[model samples]
Target chain A: MRNIWTICRKELGGYFVSPIAYLLLTMFALIFGFFFWNILGYFVNEGMEMIMRGETVPMNLNEQIIRPLLSNVSVIGLFFIPMITMRLFAEEKRSGTIELLATSPIRDIEIILGKWLSAVILYSCLLLLTALNFGFLFLYGKPDWKPLLVGYLGLLLQGGLLLAVGTFISTLTKNQIIAGAATFGICLLLWVIEWVTGYESATWATVLAYFSVITHFDSFARGVIDSKDLVFYLTGIFLGLFATARSMESLRWRS
Target chain B: MRVLTCFLPPSAGTATVAGFDVLEQPREVKRRIGYLPETPPLYPEMATSEYLRFVGKLKGLSGGELEKRVDYVCERCFIADVKQKLLGKLSKGYRQRVGLAQAIIHNPEVLILDEPTAGLDPKQINETRDLIKSLAGDHTIVLSTHILPEVEQICEQVIIINKGKLVATDSVRNLQARTRGVESLQVEVAGRDGSLSYELVQRRLEQVPGVAHVLCRDPHEHRLIFEVQSQKGQLTRGDLARAVVESGWDLNELRAASMSLEEIFLELTGSDAPKETAELTKEMQA
Candidate 1:
């Protein structure tokens, strides 16, 4: 565990010192801000129309604004998660520091976990940026915080799942751009897997839909914490990290 | 080297480092060994001290012990002056020093350095070699390089590998002695006549006892250089000198020629015939 934390701290320190951290933070916040403004604008316009008709329409801020915003955050994460995870191993390999990590007295699993945890932490910080906008919503509107918390949890799980995959892809190449592109390609495939459900309702389609990240995230976005969804994300994280450890093992042998 | 360091497993053979089987007790082997690959593994963005501290932690050092070890290595490698500078900003020599510092940060019992002096100025190369020599007894260093002078200057035992095969493993002096069987003699003779013919000198030297072969290397009018090869284990320098003088030639110089490490390396690894001969000789001696 100490070894893992040491690696994690080094990785986190690496991200903070590089310009990628600042760039990702700024890009995420700006995109989330746009989503917040558009969502809130639609909600306000609907509320005003209801008031002009003198009808008392229930405006649940959590359902109307928070859920959609959190869902949008998950989509935005598809782009930024790749950026954060691309350098985990690829940059190390490119700079020849992978030799140091490989020959170190730490287990392969620890290195993978350390790098994955750093990416998760960075993604969490990006999610935290949107909380400033949420804080504004809470100040003026009567929004239930529990559902918002669940929504944020969903975003984290979703982002972590992609980050884990990205971490695996990073180990495949020394080129960061290639790693990032491969990660985005895999994430896009996972995202669009649910489209098979739209075309058919067969067993194959149902399985494909179940495999889609968006399917598991739907319950969390709607504030329903299903055990199955948690299991899915956990399984994906475990499988991704397991594959990464395997790749790292092969790399050790080849080196 | 990677297998000995437990970074890579051997395909067919076993390796042990610091009394730990690399295949079975990799963690123990890793704990006892520090490896520096051909290129230094470094994070350019990190300061010299910070990178060393990070590597120290990876090698399982922490707290005051880590600090003390880091300080010791920083001073040992003479990089304390630039410890605060980012590694990328540092000069190549300093970067190599930092690489060396990380390898010894844990004070591992074995140091496997691949080409430690490669790609350095003459002064830095000498300094690095001196630093390596200074750490000789405390650490069992496995220094790998194609530089023969480095082996002569630093290594006590040499292992020559070619085409991924171990060609020979022995002390440097032992290898040099093994290749010294075909003794050579450098004879510079001044003839009575201004001109010296190669045919006359070659025929005369070949008739000398213990002389196996003779070649007129340089045939000048007043001076001639003859390279005389003696039969295995034969002392021919004295016999050749006497033969030249008896032949009415002024013997200016006659000395036993020695083979250098480079020549021995070429003899062992340069061709298939000599390699087979060396292996046959090894078997015969065994």
Candidate 2:
């Protein structure tokens, strides 16, 4: 556990010491702020239209605005998670420091957890940035905080699953660009797997749709926390990290 | 070295470090050994002190113990001056010392350094060699380098591997003594009034007891150089010097040519193989 924290601290330090972390934070906040403004604007305009029409349907702020915003945040994460995870092992391999980690007394599982946790933490920080915009909704409107918390939890699980896959891809190559591209490709594939279910109803298409991360996150976006969705995210994370550990073992042999 | 350090498992055999089987007790083996690869495994963005602390903690050091070890290694490796500097901005020599510092920070029982002094300036090389020599008593160091002189200067026991086979493993002096029978004497003589020819000098040297062959090389107007080979299992330096003096030739210099590690390395590795060993030796020298 101590070894994992030590590795985690160093990995986090690696992200912050370079301009990459700051650049990522700024870009993510800007994009999320835009999404927040657009969503809130659409929600207010719809409310005014309903009032002018004398409709008695009450609009729930959580569902009308926050849910769509949370969904958009997940979409934005598809672009940023790759950047967060691209350097986890790829930079170490390129700089030859992977040898130090490999030859150390630390276990392979510890190293993977350390690196993956760091990425998850950075992704959490990016989510926290979106919270500043959410703060406005809480001040003037009676937005329930519990569902917002649930949405954030959902974002974390989905981001963590993708980060694990990125971490695995990072171990496969020393080139960060290649790692980033491959991670993006894999994440995009996971995101779009649900598309297959629309065109066909075969068992394979159903399986692919089940595997899609968006399918699992849909319940959380609607303020629903099902145990099955939790299991899916945890299983994906476990498989990704397990594959990374196996790759690390092979790397030990090859080196 | 990789197997012994537990970085790679052996394919066919078992290995141990500090009494821990590398394959069976890898954690114990890792706990006991410090490894520095051919290139220093460093994160350039990290401050030197921070990096050392990270490595120390990874090796299970923490709090005051980790701080103390980090400071001790920094002072030992002469990297205290660059403790706060970013590793990427430091010079190569400093970076190498930082690499050494990190390896020893945990105070492991064994240190495995691969080509530690390669590509360093002469001064840095000497300092690193001296540092390694200073570290010998407390720590068991396994240094792998292509530089022959480095082994002769630093290592007490030498292991020479050729084409992935162990060619020789013994003390440096013992290896040199084993090759002593092939020793020759190089003699530079000023002839009487420049009257001697190459054949005359060669014939006189060959006449000496235990002298098997003599070859006159680089004939000059006033001096003659002859390389004299001793008979197998015989010492010929004293006899050849006396023989040259008695023959009325002015012996300016006569010394037994000791076999260098390079020559021995070639002799052992060259005979069994073809041109690859020669190329490898040349590469090592470069």
Provide per-model DockQ scores.
0.69, 0.81
Clashing pairs in 2: none
Candidate with maximal TM-score:
2
Clash pairs (backbone) in predicted model 1: none
lDDT of 2 by residue, A38-128 (tens): 8888888998899999997978989888898899999899999889999999998998898899889999999999999999999999999
Chain B TM-score against the true chain B, candidate 2: 0.87
Model 1: lDDT equals 0.85
Model 1 chain A weakest 10-residue run by lDDT: A246-255
User: How close to the true structure is residue A214 of candidate 1, measured as C-alpha lDDT?
Assistant: 83
Q: Tens-digit lDDT track for model 2 on B246-285?
A: 8888899987767888778878787667534332211111
What TM-score does structure 1 among the candidates reach? 0.89
Q: For candidate 1, give the lDDT of residue B181.
A: 71
TM-scores of the first chain across all predictions?
0.98, 0.97
